[model samples]
Structures are given as structure tokens and as C-alpha cells.
Target chain A: MPATLRDVAERAQVSIRTVSNVMRGYTHVSDRTRTRVLAAVEELDYRPNPAARTLRTGRTGMLALIVPEIDVPYFSALARDVIAAAAELDFRVMIDQTGHDHERERELLTGDDREMLFDGVLFSPLVTQAELLEMNPSTRIPLVLLGEHDFDDRFDHVAIDNVRAAHDAVRHLLERGRTRIAAIGAQPQEQYATPQQRTAGYELALREAGIEPNPGHTRSAAHYSRADGYAAATELLRLDPRPDAILCFSDLLAMGAMRAVFDAGLTVPDDVAIVGIDDIEEGHYSRPTLTSVSLDTAFIAEHAVARIAARIEEPDLPPEQIVAPHALHVRESSGG
Target chain B: MPATLRDVAERAQVSIRTVSNVMRGYTHVSDRTRTRVLAAVEELDYRPNPAARTLRTGRTGMLALIVPEIDVPYFSALARDVIAAAAELDFRVMIDQTGHDHERERELLTGDDREMLFDGVLFSPLVTQAELLEMNPSTRIPLVLLGEHDFDDRFDHVAIDNVRAAHDAVRHLLERGRTRIAAIGAQPQEQYATPQQRTAGYELALREAGIEPNPGHTRSAAHYSRADGYAAATELLRLDPRPDAILCFSDLLAMGAMRAVFDAGLTVPDDVAIVGIDDIEEGHYSRPTLTSVSLDTAFIAEHAVARIAARIEEPDLPPEQIVAPHALHVRESSGG
Candidate 1:
């Protein structure tokens, strides 16, 4: 068994409180007493309890990551970037999965369990505004929100311009002379930020082009996954006047949509153009490659980590919004 | 500002230690005092310092995950599974990157900062066995190891039979009448358990079939990423006696190999048979699909969690070895 504080104290013929103070680097003790405690600690090979010390000092040097799910490549890759960023700052990432659950979303913000888990939390909430407002006063940790969501006056946020990026993607397709453009994304009424904003941009772009927004050209998926994207693309291809291009919410969705297009004996860009958001690594390897809006995950990760670290260090600072920019990455799939 | 223990204690007209004891669920306190403390806690909304509690009691309810890199799909997916499993048992996963650094590996075992950070550790060490053994004793927490080396008596292990699985994969290629088979993997001399074992199995199968284990038929890459696999496979294709079949170390590697084959104007399985291991989610969706040896990650997850919980609960039990079976999943690329 490992030696304890009491064992060290007993070996030094001192109180456990003195041993604790010595271990914690508290300098109030006499030099002789500190030396005695140190010698006994070395002799007994004592290890201090982190939880106990955290309860006393109010700082555990730990951070929690709350993502919708880790199984998704975008989120998983983002998580990898976030972890690497945190490591550079000598902080560790404790991952938590909300599974995109509404009740769990509330739990992430309002639960005492989260407050007790880490010094602070980095949350990507998928809750409604009303639900979010209800969780305001109960937050006990320094939190930095990711993804597109509005908070009244509560927490700091870091995100990209989804609506503008989406418009850029649609404009890219329009420039390629693809008029019958279809958008594949989340169900319109689902009320998530990225998908909703992207869909709105697609509609706005078509309106600006003097083309009527056809309900037939917009297909909603259950969620952002390969299978869901494939299903949505299949429906788009089955349209009487099939769209010539598709804008997907994510690269994974784009990959699946491309598969469905090929399954129907159609080629990318040449036959039907495709564009997606979140320039994930796999997008570069897909058959024709993928055209995407790059959010520069590295930049986002660094900013988010720095912001959270700063917030934890200076809790008195007012909440701020930091927006990371996106760039259009033209690739073979969009005939670039 | 949040309420402190001193505030609660003052409100309850009790000592700060009594308030702490009540918060920590110490039942020795009298009911009247406990009620007063509880009411004060409710009124003030006091949150105990987690760090101090950790210092007081050695339990942290946190586990460390040390991996080579998280960008790689296999490791990333495996990590997500590990995280999910840990979550089911109510433990948090704190991530650390070794970057395959031997010094980092050593530091991880003996780092002064980690003494109180975790109760146990789940390490995937990719270093030499000598280095592994040297660092084993310095680790204060109970450890569960996952690597591709031979098991030892010092720690618990979880692994699959990479050699036998590789043999099966190669034999499947041979059964399909592909005589000129190629092997693609990382440096076999690095002492990594899975890749080394797979290389050994390939050679043994070739020898048993009265075929010389030609060095020309083997291509070694630096890592197991698809990009690396593609480069190695492309080199193999340019050989004088080009291989008719190539067995890759991982599904991501197979994806790269397939890409190389397509770029070389060849079809999978029909012109050159291919197989990979780790049957990750991408395998099912990759173009032409991937034929590979499938390790039951979900089973490993369930078992690893159970074993870790058991070890944390009962550390006196002998170190256990858990072997997850591997199966040859015949898909489009393996003439299925």
C-alpha cells in the first residue's frame, strides 16, 4: 500500500496537518519542522491526496470538455485538437459526452456534479434559449461555450460565422453555373444553430440570385452522419427535376452524399457539384476530394483553450465573444 | 462570488471542520448538528473545494489516458470507446500525449504533478519492453496496459492476437489464388506489439506455404495512417514483381492502399486483393468497402471497464489478461 500523510506524520513525530502543509508547499512552518516532514515523506514514500487538496485550495488544475458526441469525426478531430492545445498549456482535458440530450444539456450547465468535477468546463450546448437562460445562475465553473448559440449575459463563446460561410459555399456552387442547387442538412425545425444558419444562407443566396427557393431543393436529415447524409442525398437524386449541386452541413455528410450520387451513376462536379462545411481530413482523400469551408480547428482550439484558461485565472473579466474566420477551400469536387 | 465553507460554518454556528465533515458524508456528527449544517449549506449554496477533498482523501475518481496520437482514426476511435466505457462507470478520462516519446513515457510514470491527478491509469505504451519495465514501478496508480508486446506479470493487459489474425488474413489472400502477396506496415523492429506480431504472422504463413519470405514483398512505413499506407502500397506496386495481394496493418492503411491501387489504374480484389485490421467504422463506408480482421472494440470496451472497476475495487487480485478475439471480415476488397 502507498504511504499516507498520517504515516509520514507518525514517522516524523509531527501532526498530519503539518505534513499536509509541508506537502502543499505552505511556508508558515519552521525550517526544522519542514525538513523533518520532508525527510519522513521521502522515507515513507508518501503521496498526497489530490481530491483532499483540491477541496482545500479550490484549484485542481483540471478542465472538462463537454461535446455532443465523440463518435463523429468532426467532433473527434476537434477534440483531438482541443486536447493538444490544452496539453501545450500544461492542462488536461476531461471529456464528457452529452449525446446531444436536452436534459443532459441542462445538466451540464446546472448540475452540481459538473461543478465538482473540474475547475472549469468547455461546453458545446445544443439546448434552446429558454433552457439555457434557466441554467444561468447555477453555473459554478468557468465555462466557454462552443458552437453557435446565444447567451444573454452569462458565458463566453467561441464560434465561426456559419451563415456567412454557408453563403460563401452556395455562391461557390452558383459561380460554377449550377442553378438547380440542393441543400442537405439538419431538419429545418430542429432549432440547432449551424444547420439552421446554413440553410438560411442557402435560401438567402438563391433569393439574391433571382431564383425562387424551391422546397423540393431542400432536404432535411435527422442528424449529421454518413448514413443520414446518404439518405438525404438519395431523396434529392430521386427528385423529378434533380438538383445539379448539393451543399452539405459537414464533410462526412458530403462524403455520403457523393456515395449516393455515384450509386446513381453520377459523377461529382462534372455531373453534380458538392460543397460541405468543416474541412475534415477525410475530405481531402475522397474520390474527387471535397470542396469545404475551412474553420481552422487549430486556431479555434488555441483560442478556446486560452480563453478558458484566462477565465479560470481571472474570473472577474466580463464575458466576451471571439469569432474564428472560415476560408473557402476549392477542390476537385466543386470543379476547381 | 460563491459561498465558502467558512460562511456556511458561521451561519450554522459550528466549526468549519464540522461543516466539511457533514459535506463529506461523515455520519459520526449528531443529527441536530447535521441538520443545522445541512440547512446552512442549502441557504448559502456552498460547494466544497474538490482539490482540498482530494488532498484529504486519496480518491480522485479520475483516470489518465496516455496514447501515441489522437489524430489517427484507430486510436481516436479506441479512445472514444474507452471514454464511453469509463463514463458508464462514472470515471473521468484525463488525456495525455506521449507522441511516442520514450522520455515522456518515463516521465508519465514518475511525474511529480500526476501523483494526485488520478486514481488509476489506462496506458497504451508504444515503447520498448525494457523501457516499459523500467517505468512500471514508479507508477503509483493501478494501471491497465494496452500494447502489442508480450505480456508480463507486473500489470494487467488487454490485447488481441495480432499474429494469428495476420496469418488468417494472409491465408485468406492465398486461398483466393493470389500468389504474389505483399505486406504493408510500420517498422517491425520498433517493438510495437500489434504491428510486429502481424509482420511475424505474415512471414510464418509464407514460410508454411513453402514460399520464401521475400524482403522485396514487404514494405515498411513510418506509421499506420492511410497516407503512409498509400505511399508504401504505391511503392509496392512499382516493384518488378508487383504483388497481386497486399495485407495492411490497419483499416486506415487499407484505405490508403486502395487509393494507391485506384491511382495506379487497378481495381481492388479483382486486380489486387487487399485486407486490413481494426475494421473501424470507416471500413464499412469506404469505397468498395474494406476487407479486414475485425477486433471487437465494443467487447474490449465492456471488458476493460469491468476489469478496471474490479482492479480499483480489489487491487489485491493477481494481474489479469483479457484477450479479445479477432475475426476475418470478408468484404468487397477480399473477393467476398
Candidate 2:
């Protein structure tokens, strides 16, 4: 049988409470007593049972990362960074994918399934801010929102400045000597979604460039996917004056747009320049090599982890909203 | 406060034990009593505390999926399928990335960290089967092996038949009238690894086609990544009789190989045919598209979950080895 806390306490010639304090990293323990407890712990190989520790302290050292989807490149990359960052803080992450379903997101928020297993949650909600607000007060675990969400004031949020990043991508395209620029992956019905934020940025950049924003140039997709981008781009290509350049909401969309451009017998950059957001790894090896507005995923992950940890440490602490930095990577597809 | 089990029993007008039996899905309970307890549970919103139940039953209703890396496309895709399968079985999944580190894999195998949190583990070990055997007896939780591992006799395993799948991929390449076929992503140092098994299949197909297997045409990568594949392909292109066709161990490598071919001013299929294993999503959108050996990920996920559940249900049951089906998806890259 494995050694228990009592065995370590007995071996150290200390009380069980004293040993517990040392094991829990309590500063109240004397240095000599701490050293004795540590030595005994090593000698007896007394590793505390995580479940028992969780029961005592109400901290499981586990975080749940609830995202819309895991198979998508962006989410998978973000998850990787989150896991790495959590590991640095000595925490393990449990991943939950909602498949961008509102009901699933609601279930995750309201159900008792994850509350008892994970100490805290890092959620990238697909549900609207209003829905989130309605459910906020009942949340039993500390949560940090990620990606595009308008819950900054109510919850700790870590994300890139989507509007500004999208504006930068459009500005980059405008400066590339392309005037007939089109935007893909717009979700007109959703006011606070990523596509909406990016479209706003696209219009702002066009207006700033003295180019009148054309509603016809803005194409909406049901979701940010390659197939959606391809279909949107195909429609854009059918316009009387085809777009000279296209700025996409995501790398996946951009890749699809590029493919559509090729299928329509056009070359990237020379015929129709392309730029995208989310510098997913596949972009590097893509035919023309994707140029993108790159989110500092590692930076976002670090801050998200730190924020969640702080919230767990101080449950009543005021929520903090952080916008992580992003960069526009000019590559072959963008004529850089 | 949330309703307790005692409160639920009182509301149902049944004994606490009877309520517990109903909640645990025990079949011995009368239908009338079960209905009463369920009604009370719904009215009181008496969601059982998972941790408390775990403590009592020694089942956490959680599974740990320990992979070499979560960010890699193949692993992420597999994880998605696994998560979906686990969800159907009313189990949550905790992801653990070992980063293909032997020490990390060893730690996961020996340490008590996951034992208390997860009921079972689905480990895709980076370590050798010999190392796995050394650590197997000490693992506290039920475990099922995934991906490339030689632990079939001693543990439940779910994977594609790597050798046969690889042979089929090569056979497809040969029948396409390509004579100078090369193989990439061979890890010669690891005798029983996936790359080695695939390479053996590549050789088998070459011999069956009455073509002399050229050792000079076989290139080895330190790891399976686009960059590694690009470097290996660059070397392969320098051979006296450069290969006309390349079969890569992974889609990522094949994507890289395609990039290298373009860089060398060659066109896919017309100049160099490319095929890969693991038909990741990017392959569908990649320029020229990719032809690949596609493992039925959903099938693998289903069997792995079933096997693990069986193992958890009957601890002493003999380990079962299952080889999931795979298909060759012939796309634009292979001249199909």
C-alpha cells in the first residue's frame, strides 16, 4: 500500500496538522519542521491523493477549457497553448467541445457535469453575451472567457483586439495596390460575433482609405469554415467587377478563398491578393503561403491561465479584461 | 443551497438507500420507486456531486487521453473523435500531452497524479513497448492503448493496421504507373514505431511489384512534421535517380513534400506523385489536394471507448486487440 499523510507525519515526529501545513505549502510552518516533513515525505513516498486534497481545499488544480470545437485548427492551436501554460502553473486541463451549439453551451454552463470535476473553467462561448449574463450568477466555478465575447466587465476575458486586427489586415491589403478589396466570413445577424467585428473593421479600413464600403463586397457565411469561405468567394468572383483582393476572417477561410481563386483560373496576388486572420501552421506550407493577422496564442494562453489562477485564488476579485496583442504577417499570398 | 441526497429521499418518500439505488441506475429498484425518486430529483434539481460519487464508487466517470502531442493535426483529430465518443457514453475526457517526451510518458505511467482524477486512461505512448511493460503493473487505472504501440496481448488497443494500410497506399502508387517510388518519414532507430512499420509495408509492396527496393530512395525524418518532411524531400530530390513518386508516413509530411516539389519547380502528379497516411482535414484544401491512407477515426474511437468501458467493468477480462478499418482516399495529388 502507498504511504499516507499520517505515515509521513509519524515518520517526521510531527503532528498530522503540521505535516499537512507543510505539504500544502503553508508559510506558517517553521523551516526546520518543513524540511523534516519533506524528508519524511520523500522517504515514505507519500503523495497526497488529489481527490482528498480537493475535498479539503476545494481546489482540484484542474482547469476546464470549454471551446466551440477542438478539430478546428484555431481552437486546437489555442488548446495546445492553454495546456502548456496550465502545465507551467502546475495545473492540468480538461477539454470540452460544444460544437458551436448554443444548447450545448447552455448545458455546459447549467449542468452539474463539469462543476464537481474541474476547479475552474476557461470558456470561449458561442452563446450570446445576453445568454451568458442570464446564466452568470449561478456559475459555481471561476471562469475566464476567451476569443470574441462581450462579457469583459462581468467575467475575466482574454482575447485579441479582433476589430483592430481585422482593420490591420484590410489596411495591409489596401497598401498592396489593391482597391477592389472584398471581405469574406461576415455574420450580419450576430452583432458581437467575430465575423461581425471583422466586417466592421473591414468597413472602417475601406472608409479610411477613401474607398466607399460596398455592401455587395461583404459576403456572410453561416460559420468561419473553409467550405463557407469557398462558397462566399465563388459568389464574389461572379460579381460584375471581381474583387482585386480579399481579406478573410480566418486562415481556414483564407485558404478556401485561395483555392476558389485558383479554381476560377486566377492566380493569388497577381490577380486577387489574399490575407487572413489566425496564423494557423498550415498557412506556412500553403501554395502561395498565407499572410495573416497573427494572434499571439502563447501570450493569450499565459494571460488566460494567470487570470483563471488569480480568480481561483481570490473569488471575489474584480474581473479584468485583457486584449492580447496581434500582428499582421505579410507573406507570399499578400505580395510581401 | 443545492438539494442533498437526504432531502431528495425525503421528498420521494423513500429510504435514502432506495434513492441512491435509483440514482446509481441499479436494476433491482421497483419501477414505481424509481419513478418517484426521479420525479423528486427533477423537482429538487438534485444533481449528484460527481466527486462525492467518485469517492464512494471509485469511478470518476472521467477518462484521460494521454497523447504524444495535442496540437498535431492527427492527434487533435483523433482527440475530437474520442471526446465525441466519450460524451455519448456520459463520460468527460481530460487531455494529457506528453510532448513525445520519454520522461513525461514515464511520469504519467508511474505518478499518482491522474489516478485519483481519472477512472481510466487511453494512452498513446511515445515510449517503447518494453518501457510500457515495466510500468504497466504499477498503473492504478484501467488503460487502453491507442495509435502505434505493441501492447496488444497485455492491453486493450485500438488502431489501424499500419502495415497493411501502408502497403495499400504503396500499391495505389505503383498501379498508377509510377516506377521510381520513394518512401519518407522512416524512423529507423525505433524498430516497432509507426514509421518503421509503414516502411516495411512500403518495401513489401515494392518487392511484390517486382521492383528492387532502393535504400537510397528511402528518407528518414527525426519526426513527422512539415519542416522535417521538406528537409527530407529536399535530400531525396538530390538523388542520382530522383524518385518520381513519394509516399509519406503522414499527411503533414506529404503536405511538406508537395511544397518542396513546387520549390524545385516541379508539378504534383505530372512530375512527382505524392500520397500520405492519416487524411487530415488540411489535405482536402491543400493545393493539388492530397491522396492518403485514411484511418476510420470514428470507428477507432468507438472501439477504444467500448474496450475501456469493458476493462473498467470487468477488470480481470483478457485484453482484446482491435484493428480498425482504413481506406485509401485517392485525390488530385496522386493523379487519381
Q: List per-prediction Cα lDDT, in the order shown.
A: 0.79, 0.84
Q: Worst 10-residue stretch by lDDT in candidate 1 chain A? A: A132-141
Query: For every candidate structure, what is the RMSD over all alpha carbons to the true structure, in angstroms?
Result: 6.8, 9.2
lDDT of 1 by residue, A221-240 (tens): 76787887888999999887
**Which candidate number has the best DockQ?**
1
How many residue pairs clash in all the candidates, one count each?
26, 0
Cα deviation of A306, candidate 2, in Å: 0.8
Tens-place lDDT digits, model 2, residues B1-336: 667778999999998667755664546678998999999998997756665565446677888999887888888888999999999999889998988678988887666545667778898876777777887453346788888745658777888888898899989989999989999988757744787778888999999999989988889887789998898888888886889999999999999999999999989989899999999978888899999999888988888988888877876678888988999999999997
Which window of ten consecutive residues has the lowest lDDT sum in model 1 chain B? B49-58
Docking class of 1: acceptable
Query: Per-residue CA lDDT of candidate 2, range A23-121, in tens?
Result: 545455789999999999889867566655654455678899998878888888899999999999999999999986889988887664457577688
TM-score of each model, in listed order: 0.87, 0.87
